[model samples]
Target: MNRKKEILEKLAFIKSHKELVSFGVKEQEVSHNPCLSEAEIAAFERKHSITLPDDYRFFISEIGNGGFGPGHGLLPLNKAIVDFKLRDKPNISLNKEFPYQDDWNEEWIASFDWDEEYPDTEIVDAYISTAHIAGCLQISHFGHGCTFLLVVNGNEKGHIWFDGRADYSGLIPKMKDGHRISFIEWYVTFLDMEIENINKSLTNSTTD
Candidate 1:
């Protein structure tokens, strides 16, 4: 599929909608930010020593670099490291391959004992070192402490994982119809769901 074209077309549809606010789109949220130039993207890749997943790279380069996307919008590449505190923690490697292949068992997760005396930073650091994807970059904040992780290396390269930090310390593959989806697919699915909600709202309003 021509994901780039599909993304652009859906964005245009969202932009042209008259009831954007009703659809949960904030003013100037779509197509308002400057996209990254090829040079800038290249520089980022060179500095990180890894190639970004193609769909994500294309979105930032061709669509918009930030300010409009799934969740709290795609984070700017420059701010990603700091926003995610990748530098503050030495163990979080942006080049290490993502390590997990499956979701952590719920019962096993529940077994984690929270030490009241344990420093929050230490707890977070421990999790980061053990579970965080080494070369994965956060692409979006899905509200309630959830974020989308794009793997740039390891077996999961090119796949997007849903980070459910608010509820649990686990990464779940973003799946659709039992199949894993890419960044574009995830975003498009989100948009489509929003559109469906908008239509429902409109229909209900008319009937009332």
Candidate 2:
């Protein structure tokens, strides 16, 4: 199928399935400050303006909380690191399941290159699986809207979905075409916090 047509179908499916997952956002918490506003997001009428897919928004908000880690228990964002490392290893089977399974075959993996081009620095990481050829995962923060933009690689721009809030500043990197890069910095941030909490718990257990 063509890129435009595929995106349209995905959008239609997502719009219809908004209720599949609970967004966890209290209707009363819609406050606005710097990054993004409900009004601004609502004003975005074109799909090219953002980097999120209609259905993928669930992964950031309702599916995995704001940041993609272990919120849903379905697919962990940490898995991306493993996938990237094993991209050229062997026996890689790209399955179309949640988190998208992979075995690391050179032929299948080498077909895709990570650093072939200077991607947007703002985008901390990007991912692609056999599930969707045109779609790609992007991590980036927009002003106060520290969200995820799961784009369609190089086709139509993409859509923007919330990934919670963080206090950050300065210019974030975007694609050469002027699109923002996905930010995967939170994955590491969350990993550190998880380790700290675990260590603290272990210490407390020993003392107790």
Candidate 3:
């Protein structure tokens, strides 16, 4: 389904209403970056050895490369890759199957529960190298040590996940109504909420 028409309409409304405090709008500070062409997107996919999820692929090619969405704003597609390498090991690559179906930090912690008096620094070092982020592309920094990732391969492809491991919350899927939220769903929710906030702000001002 084509969302370009609908998404642009919301973006236009948000951009035109400068007086409103739309979510992430001030952080973006301007309209989003220019849209990338289909060829540009294809080239990126080729280089990365992974096909982006349909909605996200469409967004970069049709809406904008990146800028303004959830949290501190979406990042440019080129900057979205996770470093999946652990030490001298090669990257696991984005096309590899995403390793988890649910929260994974607990598993990670269990893997290296060293003695408090004699911590295994090498094991801890490996954990910090981002092995858990394999097969995903980062989309947003959710602030306060949290990140948002888009699963790039395997069964979870196309769904957004919350990388909350920094806060010891684990890698959790973004869910709504018991289902994982897709890229489009996540984005449209942001647009809807921002529009609602703008309308409320305008209404409150008029009544005053």
Candidate 4:
């Protein structure tokens, strides 16, 4: 029962069932920008040398502070409830539209395939908005965890994932002059906090 309380009880069951499945995060209005200052995240981990754990620097300084929005701009992919039972697991694919290059773009690692993969998929959460301002980030690093997330909004750019799994004609793998980026309709209205300290520590669990 460690691993940071199992990733905070799977983000409190994704923030409590996230309104029975949508995109979770209904009313979260707290602003005052200019965040990311722990000496600017330790100088962005000493100029990208690495070592930014502690649960991804407390999940980007506390569960995505000053950002995570969909008030109007874009970048929102809330589809949980186990994503409709892994929607026809030919690997699975739903949210479409992608291309926005830039962000460790070695051709987006050819959408992952570095020699037959499968270590819990890959990408673990990403969001990039174009115009105005809107940002969300996640990437739980796996099989060589270094992680990635690039948020920009003026020229528009968005990528969202939290563990990869795109195959069934999801058509992932683009970078021939990348600049696609789309999916920004709107969702994620989850709000159901306080779970009695995670159901009283999972009902006094004894390795069920």
Candidate 5:
């Protein structure tokens, strides 16, 4: 199937699943407010000087904007921008190139003295700046500040990453078979996992 058709089919499958519905998956208006049209997307891209990844671009344009996706839900483009601006430091520009070639060092984290007056805010700010992807957006939230990010620019463009800065301290690629997965792959995997969980739950319930 084509990309558009594949995305719509997957979304429809999610919506139709009874287990998914019980888990709070619901469809929302794609042709209304909060959802972007091709014109709006073009304008946003021009303003930001960056283009969204193909899979993600298709999603917001063809599927839905903010109301129905992985984790809590996909964030609307505008909302994602607003949130990023609020959290980002003034010196760091979203359009600037992301610096790191790999995930932040885990060993370096052990050197920090938790007892001292360490500048967690400043440290995290630096990390975010270095890891920032020019046109990337937060596509899903896993609660407590963890999010799935779609890379829209730079070397890792078109890949989805797990932003565990809130809990684990840095961004890491969502890998499968030692390769980073794209937005569509990640979304499909998520849906499959949810479906599996639902089936297991039903089986357990019936046994009891």
Candidate 6:
């Protein structure tokens, strides 16, 4: 079977259990939001002047629009757009180039004085822009201001990025085995982990 079909099976498996291992169960409960249609996906892409990554596009259209994903579940695509707008007062357009190709502010995350680091007005503007993480979808919120981003434009298009600006940690690519993590890889990894957790729970019950 194809990846989407495989994912569908896994989602079904996750739903079979009353007790789920993943977070966001209170809201999503292994149930998916309605799947988006191909036309709708196209419309969204046109509206934003972006091409949604294939895995993510397939996911929303073939699997689920949103629900039961990594980090407090996926936001429905439209909701993601709204979330992006609400959080970014500048209303950065999705078509804009994503500001970063790699991690920003990843080093020297230690005690510091802003006066020394951002000594100039230009640098201050850049510092503020770094936190925006423009040109992506705000797909998930892990609470405390942390969110997962799906890059729709720029060099990192099709990659998932983690924004930890909540703690001033900065934006970074989500990586596995030194390669940028794609949407399916990230989501399926979570599904497999949740399945394993359920299996372990079942085995323990049997042993008891």
On TM-score, the leading prediction is 6
Evaluate all candidate structures by whole-model CA lDDT and list the values in order: 0.70, 0.32, 0.77, 0.32, 0.66, 0.77
lDDT of 2 by residue, 1-208 (tens): 7533543344344334333323431111211112333343334323323334444342333323232232221122223212232235221221211221222122423343555853353332222222222233334333342334343334333432232212222112233344433332233333344445545656777899
TM per prediction: 0.79, 0.24, 0.83, 0.23, 0.76, 0.83
Could you give the candidate ranking by lDDT, starting with the highest?
A: 6, 3, 1, 5, 2, 4
lDDT of candidate 3?
A: 0.77
Clashing pairs in 1: none
Better of 1 and 2 by lDDT: 1
Clashes of 6: 0
For residues 1-208, write the lDDT of model 4, one tens digit per residue: 5644554455457455343323223443222233355776776445433334344355345444334333211211121101222323121121222233333222345576758963343332221111101232322121222212222122323333222222221222122234343222111211122234445455656456
Better of 3 and 4 by lDDT: 3
For residues 1-208, write the lDDT of model 3, one tens digit per residue.
4478899888888878756866446657546788889888888778878888999988888788778788788878766774322345344367676888876765656555446543367754655555677788878888875788889888899999998765657788999889999999999998888889989999999999
Q: Lowest-scoring 10 consecutive residues by lDDT in candidate 3? A: 83-92
Error of 6 at 73 (Å): 1.2
RMSD each, Å: 3.5, 17.9, 3.8, 16.2, 3.9, 3.7
Q: Give the TM-score of candidate 1.
A: 0.79
Worst 10 residues of 1 by lDDT: 83-92
Cα deviation of 14, candidate 1, in Å: 2.5
Off by over 4 Å in 3: 22-24, 82-92, 107-124
